[model samples]
Target chain A: MKTALRPSVALLLIAGILGLVALAFAWAGGWLSPRRIGGAAIADALQDNLGKPEPGWRRAHAKGLCVSGYFDANGTGTALSRAALFPAGRIPVTGRFSLGGGDPLAGDGRNVFHSMALLFRLPDGEQWRMAMDHTPIFPVATPADFVSLQIAGIPDPATHKPDPAKLQAYLAGHPETKAFMDYMKSAPLPSSFANGTYYSINAFRFVDAGGASRAVRWQFEPEAPFAALDKKTLDAQPRDFLFVDALKRLSAGPMRWHMIVVLANPGDRTDNATIPWGAGHRRVDVGTLTLDRAATEAAGDCRDYNFDPLVLPRGVTASDDPLLPARSAAYSASFRRRAIEGPRPDALTQAGEGGAK
Target chain B: MNGPDTLFAFPARLLHWTMAVLILAMLFIGAGMVSTVSAAYPALLAWHRPLGIAILVLALVRLAVRLTHRPPPLPADLPPIQAAAARVSHYLLYALMIAMPLIGWAMQSAGGYPVILWKGVALFPILPHDIVAYGWLRRLHGLLGYAFFLLILGHVGAALVHGLIRRDGVFRSMAGRGG
Candidate 1:
């Protein structure tokens, strides 16, 4: 023996050393016994940057119009989850399609990342509410990273553009952010709301009547052909063209999208919204969502609803995904802030009918 | 004393060089991650997260090999203090190699992020969700990275001294040239 240490002893010692350091880090970094991690604070920080909240507008997705619809469930949902909305029946649905970000007056032509929030009233009175986005992936992996990302995007006061240095630094620090922004840059922006597909982006758990559970994520896939206007045409159109065009499209016929649910394999990640299941993942078609009528933001019932994604029916439960709760907390905070701010006049309605032509 | 041609086992030598390149690459990639906001930021992250986990797993494997098989002892004429310094520094490097990735993984976990190892595979979190924990772990990860980088410099410096100045086989033993 070259040394007094046995191989097993040496191995154990090395493991002990590594473990010791890891334990030290866990203790020092406050990773042990995590509490009050400030999800609420992060939400507050994001809202603070949007200046004071205006009445009748959300902290984000401020430019939105609500529409009424019915979800025609074929009852396939019971196979996966015993949610009451999937009783092979029609359920009342109210939805809002909105522009991304806090500016209520921002034109639809200027935004690419749009949002859709839906509230489905099941027969038994339970509700399923979801706030989803056009993009398939979220920009940041965690709520903390989300805060950093938002803070970094705040434009410098001098240049009216966000400082490249700050963003660069942030990107360097959080590498998981690349896929989201890249998807935004590469994916075609929908020319009309009827043409866009919305993604939940975060995964959840579905428990069937037998108490069996499966990890799943969902997307609203538009039945309409995916189409987009060129930048030249987009620029020439009126600021509120999306809402106007959506209304025109609805008048012509109902707007429809398939509500598709995707299931994850054993090793698939159910917790991270940033990491998405690719195209090869197993999926099932739950039902069709048909939006039959549209109402102005002023007249829509959706304006009063918060649309928290966690409001699920009996069989559907939230997974350990941190974004789920973070989103819930933030949306509530945004709703609270806006509630206190009071209602103001909406810009689209002010321009009168046909203002977007 | 064994001849200057004595060397580490082939697997050890292989891991040494592979990890040398990977560690250096990790440091640079990590530095670039925090400094740029261009379109390439996401691309960098695509490589960063999985690479970090790879380094972590490899480090543990390397430690196993190292603990099981001892490297040839320092030259007989070498002073005790220098020998002790060399041993201490090697352990420090190993400690860093193992710690950095774990802290990063823990940090992400605490921040409610996933440690995606590849396109489809992801490792579970080592810590529970907490933004406050995430913040502290993030800072520590960066600080340890600086320490790791500096230690790497010192490690390279010592290797150069042995290879170029002292004419000892210490560097060559791990370099794969010596027996």
Candidate 2:
């Protein structure tokens, strides 16, 4: 009886040990955590990326400023409608330029990158937020990996130096970043905004007046493409040179960017921001945005702004791109955190309160 | 084992291990669901929400059982401070297990997203669209998640210390053996 029981006890112990080991692995993978896998950090990074100063705008509202255009019921373009998205007939737009380093204040002016967002209100009294980065494709899909990249790019809090080994390891592991790297290497980091194309890295849905819906990605191509800045030119000028150029444009006249919408196939997942979209899906001209007014930094019109693709108009919806949903969650969480900590008011709440209108 | 009740029961132990396995499986699958960059993956998201709800329900049942069932006493050799710490930690673990899933459900509900526990079974009726509540609940969810991580790390550390450093039967009691 003792011998028989020994085998049974050993078997039970083995099974229990196996089960516990499996469970530990699962929990560590983010199963037991409240935040979804890759959800928390993605949200945090997006908030961090968007919550900075543009030369002209200060964060006035949290969700973002809104921009509205008047269109007849038939959807034919009419004159610019009442700026329902912004209170003063202008939505506060914030722009941020940086090298693609994780640190908020990393001043490697060599590979200049720019991200701009327009927070405006629509005619229907809803808040609209749009954000884009210099590089089109995000480096990694996982929030953990994104956090790792941020840590690698950022200076060590104690030492104030970036870890070269970690950065090299990260770059080596993600070869897909090569396409974006190639683009950055070839493209000029300009004092003027005329050299590079700023892409809406994530895909969005646009509904035409006819009720036809299409997945759209936006790219702002300069009228005349300029060669990328060499290492010598970058070292000569201060990092804020791009801001001065943009300010000059605003001072000169209405600065305009042709908003070209790249049409995506409904069935195509190739060009989703998480993965590369093939060149087969060509972009079509949608409309133009003319920045007629200068942005003021003292007015607090452009602080803590974030871009979520989910914040679209009635005609516009979001695609099933994994990054879009992840971004929506991330942006919402970050905005929420900032709002609670004070200084920045919740955009959605304020928009409802008629702050933007 | 001349001490106050501390060691968990056979049923409690079994439930703990089983729940552990299930929760871990859910996490692994959750990670895979996000990491796998394919169009077919959204179909998998349909599974994650429901599975999370199921885990939440199981956790609640486990908590109820733990509260009702009197566990075996800890080894008399365990100091009062260590025993108190163990009790507090266990309660925290239970709290985290229940809180994590509930917060996630509330966050999704506040976002006006569906909370389908199973394919058709709705856990809670859809929440009225409230952006303020959504924001508050989402932040709470994220904070609680970090808290949960800290608690888990502490629990693991204590267990390792007991098994490796203390060289006591404290680990074996939970390890399910009569020495």
Candidate 3:
């Protein structure tokens, strides 16, 4: 094809050159190695889907209330995990309860996520952070898919709403999304933050004294009874009703949850966050978590925290769930962005006016 | 034109140009990172972390090369003060190149943040976690970053003075052509 080269030889040379260029790009982009999906990309993807990111607010679950308390371990967990908190003592804890959405000003309403994120302060300066949603599992399987879902959810500028056709195409390819949707629609709406079971959907390795590691997932099973949420009552409540309700409930008495760990039976997938382990798996009640006080996020102990799901203790190790690292990176990116953005504007406005706490 | 005696070792020239390009990119990326809350921060940070470590490694090698094989002398007519300034500035550049990455590693360690170069490869924490220490180190890193930029400006000025104005071989020695 060329002036001096045969057709096949020329094609091979072109292909070789193209391949080398691709290799060079891969090396630079970290594709040649186990380069992660960039946290900034995923974080931006989420903010894009969520609309304009609020200054000094989380990119997701922006509206939240912080709580302080302790975890009373009954020693039942020591059989599975050698975490210092599992040694039957009251360990200091800080946590937050939030409604999922990017808008901190969004009202408490239906079809939104309710979540509890915790930081358990163990002995000798070790801390374990856990963020769990009311739902039993993550909506997607991997970090890349999560990013793709966020991109798919980006609003059409002309309509100011996500393109339904794009979402439908995404759902057709990802049955996991359909499964998550089905579960959401069929599952009883949480009546209150205290009433919902907060699940650590991703599997983790619980290492015991003998150095044996067991695949496990856990939930904070609430002491409060569950009841299907009444829609009319929910609609009538104020914008910050969830936070108000949580404070009200706490004022009367300390709220509690039992830390329950579910061990994987043989052949259960520890890597995939979307798959649910069979019901026959053994579960152990590990500890009791008690919340005694509530504080506004503006001045709360949890204010600057980034409740990354991958922050595990010495006894706890991350599983093959790729989303774990993705969560950590994205949360750090979000945290860094807000930290640079400075104090929340509402906090500043309130301070300027000498408003009541 | 650079005489054979004036030119640096071949390896030295290669490392110089390689590091010059990398360090300049690092400065711009660092500036972009703090100036915005955009989603692009993560990608910038990804490149920054690995690139910073690479600069550190290259700086160490370059220093070794310099120590073992002394650079060419300044021109015979050069002022003593100018020569001293060159010596001092070059040392400062090397120190900053080394210190910036070390401080970044320490800051991440103290803050209990991961120094993830890329997926699957994470740099080890060299310091214990202390939030207060992390805050102080972060401030120091920011301050040093500015100082490094200024030092680079002075360097480029010195190089240009020798190359274009004085027509000395100083710049040509490391320019990677007919030295």
Per-residue lDDT, model 2, residue A209, is 47
Kindly report which residue pairs in candidate 3 clash with one another: none
Tell me the TM-score for chain B of model 1: 0.93
DockQ of 2: 0.08
Can you give the DockQ of every candidate in the order shown? 0.01, 0.08, 0.08
The prediction achieving the highest TM-score against the true structure is 3
Please write out the lDDT profile of model 2 over residues B1-179, one tens digit for every residue. 52334466777777877876665555555545543323323445557677677778889888788779977666678899989999998888787777777777876665544455542244553455444566677677656655665565566556655554554656655656642
Reference-based TM-score of each model:
0.59, 0.50, 0.70
Question: Global lDDT of each model?
Answer: 0.73, 0.53, 0.78
Q: What is the lDDT of residue B97 in candidate 3?
A: 96
How should the candidates be ordered by lDDT, best one leading? Answer: 3, 1, 2
lDDT of 3: 0.78
Off by over 4 Å in 2: A1-39, A42-110, A141-144, A154-159, A207-213, A222-228, A265-271, A274-282, A340-357, B1-179
Candidate 2 is graded, for docking, as incorrect
Report the number of backbone clashes for model 3.
0
Candidate 1 segments whose C-alpha is farther than 4 A from its true place: A1-40, A231-233, A354-357, B1-179
| Each prediction's fraction of true contacts recovered | 0.00, 0.07, 0.00
